[model samples]
Target: MISNIAELIADRIGTMPASERRAAQTLIANYPMIGLKTVAEFSAAAGVSSPTILRFVSRLGFQNYPEFQSSLQDELAAQLQSPATRTLNPPSPGGGTVSPMLEATLDNMRETFRHLSDKQLADIAARLADRRGKTFLIGGRFTDPLARYMAAHLAVIQPNVFHLAGQESMWRDRLIDMGKRDVLVIFDIRRYQNSLVRFAEKAHQRGVQIVLFTDQWLSPIARFARHVIAGRTAVPSAWDSSAALFVVAETLIGAVTRQLEAEGAKRIREMESLR
Candidate 1:
């Protein structure tokens, strides 16, 4: 049985026909979220025909679309089942509706940290601490602010932190060097942009170490990422929550701060002195 339907789709997405590939990318990006939504809903969202989505599903080795959805739910049961959304929950003992939202945010942070190993965090911290290589950070429309904020935080304790938000000229200059021992940190969640994926692929081909902070749905960029931090984002709202994403940014700042030691401290002191 295919325990990882998302990974299976991701594995074969590159070779799928154009229309099928579009539908598959949407499915992979939303992951089990797509599982709860019907084929019609998914097709409309993917801008593809229902038959295209079905063929994409069948190609993934499922008997039918319903079977595929079932596999996705089974594969991602833990993530899909959020405590905040559970109907079995008693009314807040405090007798208020607001507590669940706050508690879910805390839970998001806890789950994010729980899955990330200390060693992995430390290694990524080490890469960020490198002064020999320039650090370039980028993210999609929704995630760009987080990337910018991380760059700001890194700059306080280190040199060579560059935040790249797309302006055609800026991207051209920033990406001029390949194989230059630079670190490219990307924050890519759902609705994954092909532009970012292509850039990441190109960077990887040029020996850039890509650090990716992404939703657990995972992206094609995962194949090229040197460091992949997958976090869960659950909220009661229509939009995807970025609370867990902030936890990761803060964690990276904390890790890199500690990893830099004397030099990092001295840089902070000097920066503060000027202020």
Candidate 2:
């Protein structure tokens, strides 16, 4: 969710002590362009001590220097692969620059898929296929489209699929009313919204089953959720690409739909006749 590191730094710069402002400025100015440069490298570039860099990261809400660097690297990688960057330096005829971008996206997806165990998928499939539970799909801001898509697709083949959208004031309290028989499926990526976290926390307190689809295992909301499915979508264009996430969402819905068709077809027909 940290789309522009510079902008993020700038927004928070006023809160930082005057001593750290210069280091913060340096990060804002030359973040995505710089590779995996160490804190020492950044410190030298910013004409500050490494400890100052550490403080700068802490001030920005990162747990430590290493965590800050990891987040920055992900943001930088996305920025570099953005279409705007590619357009700035067009490849020569038949040079095939797009291959690298494509490969990077595929590699990310492969790593994410590898990280998921069969047991995890099976458990998630079971939850999604459960007819007795109400499935609440929640996403905010940039990820809202993903949640809506999943909810709509699943609704066609499953019952009790709900998409939580619109203003938080209107839906937040209602969403929390879900209980143990309900599952909350939340999609959150980097630069995640605070409101989503609050909603997840509330849902967790109510004993609702929580399924999270996110970019990394280290996501802050992961702890509150019952299941975590890592979506290794490419980070490009200062925006996280949800291509892989969408694929996973659809695949999950498809699996659950198949199960429902196999297990509940007769009941589903009876219910449909009542409607």
lDDT of each: 0.81, 0.77
Off by over 4 Å in 1: 1-97, 178-180
**Candidate 1 lDDT, 1-275, residue by residue in tens:** 22366657767888889999988878767765875688899999899888988898888888998898777666567545775544323344664566767778888888988989989988899999887888889888788898999999998888888888767456646666746588999988887878889888888888889999888888789999999998777766566767798888898899888879889889888998999
Clashing pairs in 1: none
Write down the worst ten-residue block by lDDT for model 2. 86-95
Off by over 4 Å in 2: 1-97, 263-275
What is the C-alpha local distance difference test score of candidate 1? 0.81
Q: Which has the greatest TM-score?
A: 1
1-275 per-residue lDDT for model 2 (tens digits): 33455656867888888768988777656754431588778888888888888888787788987787788677657757785753322342465556556666787777877887767877898898888889899886788899999888788777788898778986786865689989999998878888889888988998999999888644578989899888776654456677677777877877787778764576567768989
Pairs in steric clash, model 2: 1-190, 1-191, 78-235
